[model samples]
Target: MHDTGDAETTVILDNGGHNIKLGVVGAEGPRLIPNSIVKAKHEKKRVFVGHEQADCSEKFSLFYVRPIERGYVVNWDTQEQIWEKSFSKFDIEPTTSRIAYTDNNYLIPALPDVSNEIFFDKFGFQEVHKASASGFVADHAYKIRRERCACVVDSGFSWTTIACFVDGVLIQESVIRIDVGGKALTNKLKDWISYRQLNVSEETHVINECKEDVCFVAMDFEKSMIEAKKRFDENMIEKRYIMPDFQTSFRGQVKGIREPLASDAPSIVLGVERFAIPEILFNPSDIDIDQCGVAEAVVESITQSPEDLRAALSENIIVIGGSSCFPGYRDRLLQDVRSMLPAEFDVKVSENVANPETHAWQCAEKLLEYPAQVAWINRKEWDERGDSLEYSRFFRTTVTSDELKATTQEFEQKGEKSPKNGEEEEF
Candidate 1:
């Protein structure tokens, strides 16, 4: 690792599809901001950015225009607007300050170009460093667990990906991704709710909140389904979700299993959908997504690594991102991975559910200590080399645009709306 020695302000951003995590390298933690520009139907002609109207408790249809789609930046104009709104808080001197960005591996061969044009040409930033959403997880693990080899299972908004690293360097060949994540689960929950209860097709924002407040992963799929069928007081898996009136509350609440509610209050009786929703991560085929489940992908990723590092990677599987925050996610994933691996291989899965989505931001903040290793592109360097990326310093993966395109098509075909980055991070 090489240090630049110059103390330029490096803004660390863990840009996810649902939220953007922003902070300075030395700050205690990242500040999370909603990543979309929302246009509420009631507030006609007025647009809100960075959650300006997010807390406006009212009944309205939210039409969002996000810059990112399927873990990549597709509409740079909208992205620029969001970034402009977010950048106001940082007191940054673009000519001198630096940017540390992470996204879906930046393997598209064109992301760096677009990013440079924006940060350098438009935003006037002096330097920019980019990495994958999972680029720094290996290094972060090594720092805490002293584990030089790790397999990172990042289950975020756009999708879940499994990547293996040996000695903190990515094994490009050992990368596998499945199109199952928070957004998928949220939409699934919304569909189930609409089918069994009320229609919430336009209430995406509320439905998402409904999911966060009530959903959980099932440790045993069969047992949980059986438990979900039990009567209210007798059911251990059942819960009452009280929907916000928008007049008093902005988000829904998950009450006790037998909690009483006002007769007029809007509520949903959550049952098998809670566990069944998250189960898609373990069996994407359940949603008709033609990809292996998260655990299967993890095993596939590790088995593709060098034979010697497989054991080390197995013992250091670190799971992060938004979807991984679900209750019972770690235990279920650990059990599934252990069951699929060879009998002699010992499997260990680690999770920090408190704030799993911030792990990438934390790791990116640590990468600031080694500017040379990260390959910061200053203005002068950008002028000389144009917008081309140095693939050698950048992380590369076998996951392709075709795979991503297929994933996008599958979701859209199923009537699932696209969400911004993760637990996919960004610029």
Candidate 2:
């Protein structure tokens, strides 16, 4: 704790592709801010950065200038602006405070160089640590359950990743990334709603709100499909989502199918889509995405790890990230994962019931509590170790882009050998 910096002064920034969790280490909770500059259709000339978009009106649609793409910071300028505002909450000058943040598992090789340029040169931060999101989940698991081996299924905004951790250390070779996540789910919901009821293709923010409000993973996809096809009076899964008009309402809300509605009010009727939208995460091929689902990826990651840790990994599986917040996510994931594993092996899947995005930040705080684990690079080390500086000293750095391409191809090849008819009996 002493080596990292003062807990009261240290800043925790869990910079996810969709939302950035920011707060001082001692704060009760982190401020979840959108990680994109928003362009409100009503205010074309004015762009809202981070949480400022909450004030503007999305009359037609809202466009975003996202700093991070595919989980890596691609535009540092946009990121710096968001960071500038987020850091301003703690101090005008972060030159003295330490920072801890999370990144994607399979990161861009050169992303760290540009990130360091921003950390040291642009912002003048004293010390910083970049760890994979799942690594912190592993850290938390080790501390709470004392489970040395665990598999982390992190389905975030951009990518859904499954990685194995043995003794709180990530086995880099066991990391598997899926192309489906919150963004993909949102897009699918948008497409479905556009095709079925309303044209909400341009209404990304509104559609995302609609998705979160009503979407839930179906435990039995076939059963849910049966319910979805039933009459409105007999269908229990049918929901009526009232779209926001921005007068008295802010965002959309899910209402019961029998609920009252005005004649002129705009609304979308959600049927099987409530479960089908989230189905992509379990079976990406449901929407033509070649990647395997979360449960399959989790099994693949654990099986590839050392044989001794596979059982332990199965027993202590943790799913963290935005997509994991869905209502039936845990139950559905546990069912699928258990089905794939041997009947004798114990299987359990869990997520932060309160908030999935903040799990990593909480773990980061706990990780910093033990001084022995603080591997921050201060200005002195950044200056002295010009050529010898190793980014992997703090966390595992992913392979280069070319190597990453090869790994993706390998994933596609392995995806062909999916679990016992994962999505074979689709609706």
Candidate 3:
């Protein structure tokens, strides 16, 4: 950990599929901006980015084109547009500030090249460091109490991943990814609502809002399902969500169960959909995906690590990201993980109650208080070495793409099939 006192300013960017959390490193908190460029059905000519999207007159039927897909930045042009807005709106001078950006661990193979092109060649930043957001969270844990071993369950918009960190370094072999996330949950809810009440397949923006406002993980799945099946009037599970007029409210509001009225605007009665959507994270097989759930993924990921570190990892499980904000999620995950583990080994799961979605950004800010010159590359160094600069200096993972490829090939040749559709398998 080299001292970075010479750097005048530091900027932290916790880029996610749904929202981009960014601000000056030392600021009290980070500002969350929409990570996509959106186009509303009512407003065709005007494109909304970041906070501008919130100002759209009609949020319903809004179509979004995001730079990130499946947690990886695939479209640089759109990503650049979003970044430009964020930087300008935040009054950040890229060339003068040291930038720290978060990338998904699975995308590390391509991130270095893309990151170099963007921050160094394009924006001309003074210095840049790229690391997984989970790595930063783990580092923050180590910073506060010197906790070295932990498992991170990051349930974001595009995917939910389980990663293990030992001594602030991520163990690549102990990483597992489940394709179920907020977007999938939203889509599932949309399908359920469309099948039962209204056709909302195209109303992604509205459906997503509904999910955030009402969805929760069920502590007891069977009992919740029983309650969901009761009559709307007698059922405690049912809640009426008043659809936004768009002309006035611009966003829908969740109302208590009520009788239909002529004056009442369009609405949907939400019941099982609330817990059913999030249930996919606990049981991916419900949606026909063969991958294990978050708790199972955590267990599988920890099994890949050294025997001595397993207990520490299980005892320090940290859940983060927007999806983790759902009510009962933390408790339910803890229950499931606990049931799967031996009674002798204590299992503890924790989440940031105040700002779980931006925990990574908060951790990144805390990380800046320590020495970090070794973790960042300056413009002079970038210009001299180009892509030859070792990414391990900035990234915590030491595993190479080629090495992983060879390992996968060896597994395949040995008649063991790799997980399909990029789903992670237990090592």
Highest lDDT scorer: 3
Give the alpha carbon lDDT tens digit for every residue of 109-228 in model 2.
Answer: 444546666777888887877677788778666655456566888889988888887556677667888988899899988888899889999999888888899999999999999989
Of candidates 3 and 1, the better by lDDT? 3
Q: Which lDDT tens digits does candidate 3 get at residues 74-178?
A: 888888889988899889988778888886543356653476668877787777887787888887776554666778989999998888876677777888889
Local distance difference test, candidate 3: 0.79
Task: Give the TM-score comparing model 1 with the true structure, all chains together.
Answer: 0.87
Off by over 4 Å in 1: 1-7, 110-113, 143-145, 351-354, 369-373, 387-389, 396-427
Worst 10-residue lDDT window for candidate 3 reads 418-427
How does candidate 2 fare on TM-score?
0.88
The window of 10 residues in a row where model 1 has the poorest summed lDDT is 417-426
Residue 124's C-alpha lDDT in candidate 2? 82
lDDT of 1: 0.73
Q: Which stretches of candidate 2 lie above 4 Å from their native place? A: 1-8, 90-92, 105-113, 351-353, 370-372, 386-388, 396-427
Report lDDT (CA) for all predictions: 0.73, 0.76, 0.79
Better candidate number, 1 or 2, judged by lDDT: 2
Q: What is the per-residue lDDT of model 1 for residues 356-416, given as tens digits with 9 covering 90 to 100?
A: 8888887777666555666666677667776444454455443433333443455457652
